[model samples]
Target: MNTVKELFRGNIRQYGMVIALLFIMVFFQILTDGILLKPLNITNLILQNSYILVLAIGMLLVIITGHIDLSVGSVAAFVGAISAILMVDMQMHFVPAMLISLLIGALVGAWQGFWVAYVRIPSFIVTLAGMLLFRGLTMIVLDGKSIAPFPKTFQKISSGFLPDAFGGKIHMLTIIIGIVLSLILVFSEWRKRSTQQKYGFEVGSGALFALKLAAMVAVLNIFTYVLATYEGIPNILILLFVLIVIYTFVMNRTIVGRHIYALGGNEKAAKLSGVKTQRITFWVFVNMGVLSALSGLIFAARLNSATPKAGVNFELDAIAACFIGGASASGGIGTVIGAIVGGLVMGVMNNGMSLVGLGIDWQQGIKGLVLLLAVGFDIYNKNKGVS
Candidate 1:
């Protein structure tokens, strides 16, 4: 009984968002008369939430280091403006414009990182200042006007679907890819458990393991089906996959990832252990800046324009998603998957409410209530030792 209870606890955090997702999916399906799960809408939903997922992954790392980044939305706006200016005003090539915008983002990150890490300023303060500074710069750079009509190659970053010519209408192929990926993930999990078992560490129960894998496979197959039925997967989804793989590896396998978790768990201990807490903090922000810039570029590309208000209130969405996805407000405990789940929850709610013809005011109120519930439940679980 104790083993079973512990297994449940260990897996609770992993499944909470999944459960919430299903609940929302069912509710919306009923409300929309089953339109919510229409393959095309499902495909669009994934694409729509892709930017927040990107930001949340980076933000999760930053938060895991006991820091926060409030400047990402503004940085994205600045990057969008820069990309537009380069391509439109200067007639620069797409590749060069992208590189230059990304470089500017890196430099901006370095600036804020230096202040927070080396100058001993609080990250919250430094990034808050950056928030204002970058927003103003975005306005100045774009001269308070929207820039439009980016080149097709540049605009394709967010709006393009994968070329069906390469793999033509093959839902079976997509399903096969998902199955292979699932198998790889399952084998990896089994190896890790076996290693732990060898060391006399308790592994989760067989039941729990089966439950987790089954859930993963179900979701993966459903997602694959949706994309395959629609546009055969988006280019942005491919980019998101690459990022997830890279970031997951970095967070799980790399020394930097370890240090970040350590810093979040205990700053003084991490500093004493030669973890270079300050440098890690610095790089985390730098990375956040880069991802923000990328998100901004994609947002601009998706709209085929850069506007003064392109990223208004975007930071709140990212932060809310992180918190809702199981990030501890007190810091140190969260996952990339959690953030994505949180973003999806928010995205789904938004999409569903719109489908049901909820006015903007009601939607905002409902979303706020959901956020409160999620964070409140997370706190309750922590205090109750439920997870």
Candidate 2:
């Protein structure tokens, strides 16, 4: 019992947000007459929120380093416009167009990073300027008009699904993939626990561990089942999975990740300890740029056009997701998974409210309130911890 209490107390913020997400889902599920979790809606939820989630992952790293980027939405729009020019006007293939767009994103990041990291400007100011600059550039690139009708192959980036290997009523491949993922999850957790025990680290009781594993496996299978019943897993989902695994590993297990946390925690101390604060900051922004460009591509693909307003207010959503996912305002704290969870919470609420016939005004207001509450909760926890 005491171990359980300790565990929960130590991870209250993470656990709390997760529980809140589940509660919100259930509440809406009940109110919407079970429309909240419909397979079709579920798929839409993932598709609509994918870009923001991608930005959140990159934003998490930025926030951890005690900085912010207000220009991601504009950057995304700029990239989308450029891609449209390449693919639609020049008649270039989607593959090369995407690669060029991503390269452009990296350059944009480098530009902002140079000012913020080397020039020693505040990130807020640098990115604010970038926000206006990029938005204007996007408009210029598209001639203040929307570009449309991208190649069909490019369209698949946002709308395509994995082909079913076995012909049946349901997608058998999705089910098999789910089972494989579940087994990997279980094995990884068990191995982690064993390692913890070997190192004299505290771990939950056997029964508690088993219960947690069972719950997780059940949820995984159920989610997969729903997708299987639909059109199976999306190609974008595979991309997201790969990104999550890579970033999670980078953040949790890499020296670069530790340096970022250290820099965020205290720039002076990190520099004194031989960490390249400026270089790290530069790279983080560069990373954000690439992700923002990727996000722009995805959005453009989904819309089948590159509009000037393509990424309006995306930075706000990504920022809100980081904070709501338990990222600290003072920095040096956050996780990739937490940011994704936070994005999902926002996504679910948006989808749910829409289903309930809420107006855009009310939806915006409610989301603002939720963001405030989430940040307030973080501050409260911090104050309590200090006390």
Candidate 3:
């Protein structure tokens, strides 16, 4: 019993969010008369939350560096407008247009990074300016108009999915993919444990490791099943998966990742220890810009058009998701998985409420309260040294 309690203590934030998610899901499942978990709605939940997950991942890194980004949403909108102009008005090819949009995002990041990192401006100020600047640029480019009917290839970025095939009754392809992914994840974990053991660090027990692998496999299988039941796995899902893996690895295993955490934990100490604070800050924003662009493209593809008002207030959702997911506002502490879970919780709440015919007013108020409680809990836990 003590051991189980210790496990929960060690993983309190994760478990907390997971418990909240389950509770909300169950409550809404009952409220909606069993419509909350319909395979189609479940799949849509994943699709709808994918962009938030993307922005959340990048936001995690930025927050880790003890900073915040208020411009990701505007940057996304700007990229979507550019892509629309290039594809629809200028009649550009899909690949080049996409590349240009990405480049524009990178440039926007670089611009903000320069002010925040090199010019010694506070991130809040720089990003506040960026929030306005990019929104203005988007309006200028789009001229308060909507662009539509992008090329088919571009539409596939979000709407396309793989066929359900591989073996027989099951979505063989999804199952196989899940199994392969599980293997890769387990192998990676094994390697990590081996490395820790070699370094004479406390490697978790063999049984613990096995249990972890089992949990991962179970999650993958369940997710694949849900997607298979709906319409197969989406291409955006694939992209989101790859980014998660890559970013997770970076945050967990790489030197740069360490630098980010170190900077977040204590900037003075990190700088004293020779962490390139400016460079890392610049790169973090650069990565944020790239992901924002990618998210913009996905959003456009999903809508089958780009509107002048795309991505309004999206930055708030991403920030709220990160904070609600156990990230410290002061920076230096957060997890990629935690951010994803937080985004999913918000997504599920929004979806369930909508399904139950809840009004926007009540929904907003409830969500705001939930966010406050979550962040307040984190602060309380930190003060109590609960973890």
Candidate 4:
């Protein structure tokens, strides 16, 4: 019982958001007459929220480094417009067009990063300027018009699904993949626990560990089953999974990640300890730029067009997700998984309300309230910890 309490106390934020997510899902499921978790809706949920999730991941890093990027939405719009010019107006291949767009994103990042890192400008001010600059550029690039009918290959980036290897009513491949993932998750957790025990670290009880593992595996399988019943897993889901895994590893296990946390925690101390604060800060922005570009591409692909308002207010959603997922508003604290969870919370709420015939105005108001409550919750926790 004591170990359980300790475990819960140690990971309250993570466990809390997860429980909240499940509770929200259940609440909506009941209210929607079981339509909330329908396989089709679940698939749509993933597709609709993919771009935001990507931004949330990148935004997590920025927030962790005690900074924010207000220009991601505009950057995304700009990149999408450029891609449209390359692929549609210029008749270029989607692959090369995408690569060029990403490169442009890097350049944009470098531009902003230079100001923030070297010129000693506040990130807020720099990105605010970038937001306006990029949005205007997007309008200029597209001539204030929308472009459409992206190549089918490019369209697949957002809309395509994995082909079924076995001909069946249900997607066997998805099921197999689910099982494989479950096994890997279990093995990894077990190994982590064993290592902690070996190192004399505080570890949860066997029963508690078993319970957690069971819950995770069950959720993973159930999610996969739903996808299998539909059109199977999406290509974008694969991309998201890969990105999550990579960023999670980078944040949790890498020296660079530690340096970022250190820098966020205290720039002075980090610099004194030989961490290249300027370089890290610059690269982090560069990373954000690339992810923003990718998100723009995905959004453009989904809509089959690059519009003037392609990424309007995307930065707000991404920022809100980070905070809701337990990121500290003052920075130096957050996780990649937490940001994703936060994004899902918002996505689920949006879908649920839409299903319930809620007005858009009310939806926006509710979301604003949720964001406030989430940030408030974080502040409350921080104060409690300090006290």
Using Cα atoms with residue i matched to residue i, what is each candidate's TM-score against the true structure?
A: 0.94, 0.99, 0.94, 0.99
lDDT of 1: 0.86
TM-score of model number 1:
0.94
Candidate 4 runs further than 4 Å off:
none
List, residue by residue over 230-284, the lDDT tens digit for candidate 4. 9999999999999999999999999999999999989999999999999999999
The lDDT per prediction is 0.86, 0.95, 0.87, 0.95
Query: What lDDT, from 0 to 1, does candidate 4 have?
Result: 0.95
Error of 4 at 358 (Å): 0.8
Candidate 3 has a TM-score of 0.94
Worst 10 residues of 3 by lDDT: 163-172
Clashing pairs in 1: none
Error of 2 at 87 (Å): 0.4
Better of 3 and 4 by lDDT: 4
Model 3, position 247, has a per-residue lDDT of: 89
Model 2 vs. true fold: TM: 0.99
